[model samples]
Target: SQKIEQNSEALNIQEGKTATLTCNYTNYSPAYLQWYRQDPGRGPVFLLLIRENEKEKRKERLKVTFDTTLKQSLFHITASQPADSATYLCALDMGSGYSTLTFGKGTMLLVSP
Candidate 1:
């Protein structure tokens, strides 16, 4: 069975440091990997999208990587701040256009000052 997973444990980090989050999968192949941020009581906001053919993609202080060999993706936040604290989600889209995304349960990141 195909499935996606992210650490259910919350990641705690100090200000001015980097935070690393992991997403792993098994028995699944996705055309695109999408990362999103969701605040309390708010919907997820788009962060980064990495294609199956791409090794890595970066935007501003964030970076995302997709490794089909290992069937895993990593999401990173540099110089994390308290404002950056949120529930981070990883979703998969097969690029069928009409198909819905398969989303992970998301991991919580707490950046303390």
Candidate 2:
């Protein structure tokens, strides 16, 4: 069976530091990986996407790395602030010929000043 997983616990960080999040999976090979940010009681907002062939990608203060061999992705936020606090999710596109995404449970981030 295919499985995607993120940290089940909340991560706490001080303001102005970098926060790193991990996403792991097993039993699946995806064409691309996406990371999203979800606020309370709202839908997720897309942050970054990395193709299986790409080793690393970056936008603004955000960065993502995908390792197809390990079936894992790492998400990073530099100069993180309290406003950056949110639940981050990782989704896998299984190339099922549909526009559907399989997501992990999400990992919450709490940035304190």
Candidate 3:
């Protein structure tokens, strides 16, 4: 009964701007949350991971915030560029130290010059 969804459309934007993405879910009790960046026809690269007890996590220009009460997560990319254009994914931990990641369809980001 758990579900995760992300924007299916490509986000078109100019270079040097911040891009925001969303991940929404329901009926999942996750011990931790993870975000990944994927390029066309390739495996997703792990971005950030936040535990249930944590409020926020960051890596360089990327920031992620998790809200368990709302069952949602937010991903942010500051000073995004054309090279940053890629699909971002979110995963929820299913527990047992062996967690299963259910990825969203992903949202493509397009950064123009």
Candidate 4:
């Protein structure tokens, strides 16, 4: 069986600080991993995708590091702001194409003034 878990609590922090979130998994061999940002009542928007062979990936303000050996991934948002507050989701690509994604519920991020 495969399982993924993210922090269920909302991370509250002041603006202009880096926010770090964790994703943990067990017993899954995923072909690819993705991170997405989702606002309330909206669909998730893809942020970064890292393959099994790759170690780390980055986009403008976001950085993601994947460690297959540890069965974990770390997501970082630098200089987070109130506007950056949202839920972040981590998904595993199962590679079958039919039911390809298994997503962790998400971790809510709250950046305060």
Candidate 5:
């Protein structure tokens, strides 16, 4: 079985600093990995996706890196702000008949001024 692990504790950072979140997994061979941002009382919004063959992917101030060899993924936000404060989640496809997504508990990030 595949398992995903993330920091259960909240990450606190000051505004204008880069925030790095980690996602670690074991016993899973995922074709791709996805990152999402979830606000309080709102569903998660897609952030970035990195394929197995791709080392990294970026969008605006967001960056995601997938290292299959290490079975880990790193999600980064540059020049983070208070608006960027949210719970970040990492998801993996189950790779079965249908599209089944397995998501982590998510890491909460707090950006203060």
Candidate 6:
């Protein structure tokens, strides 16, 4: 069985600073790593995805890195704002299809002015 872990504590940062979130896994080799943002009492919204063969991927002010060798993934948000505050989740897609997925409980991020 595979397990995913993300920091259970809230991460606080200044509005202008970059926020970094970590996701580590054990006992599984996934083809893709996906990041999502979830508001309290709501479903997660998709953020970014990185393939196992890729070192990093980015979109706008967001970036994601997948290091298969380390069994870890890093999610980054540059120029973070209060609106960016949310719980971020990391999910594993075992095959290329992304249909088979396992998710972590997620970490909370709070950006303050």
Which is the leading candidate under lDDT?
2
Candidate 3 accuracy as TM-score: 0.93
Query: Which 10-residue window of candidate 5 scores lowest in summed lDDT?
Result: 92-101
- Ranking by lDDT, best first? 2, 1, 6, 5, 4, 3
Model 2 weakest lDDT span, ten residues long? 93-102
| TM-score versus the correct structure, for each prediction | 0.96, 0.96, 0.93, 0.93, 0.94, 0.95
| Residue pairs in candidate 3 whose N, alpha carbon or C atoms collide under 3 angstroms | none
Which scores higher on lDDT, 3 or 4? 4
Q: In model 3, which regions exceed 4 Å deviation?
A: none
Give the per-residue Cα lDDT of candidate 4 at 17: 97
In the range 92-112, model 3's lDDT, one tens digit per residue, is 887767777777778888888
Alpha-carbon lDDT of model 3: 0.86
For model 4, state the Cα shift of residue 29 in Å.
3.0
lDDT scores for all predictions? Answer: 0.92, 0.93, 0.86, 0.90, 0.90, 0.92
RMSD of 1: 1.0
How many angstroms is residue 33 displaced in model 1 relative to the true structure, after the best TM-score fit? Answer: 0.4
lDDT tens digits by residue: candidate 6, 48-98: 878888999999999998888899999999999999999999999998563
Write candidate 5's Cα lDDT for 19-91 as tens digits: 9999999996688788989999999998887878899998999999889889999999999999999999999
Q: What ranges in model 5 sit over 4 Å off?
A: none
* lDDT over C-alpha atoms for residue 7 of model 3: 77
Clashes of 3: 0
Candidate 4 structure quality by residue, lDDT tens digits, 1-113:
67999987889989999999999899976778889999988999989988888889889889999999999899999999899999999999967866478899899999999
- lDDT for model 4 comes to 0.90
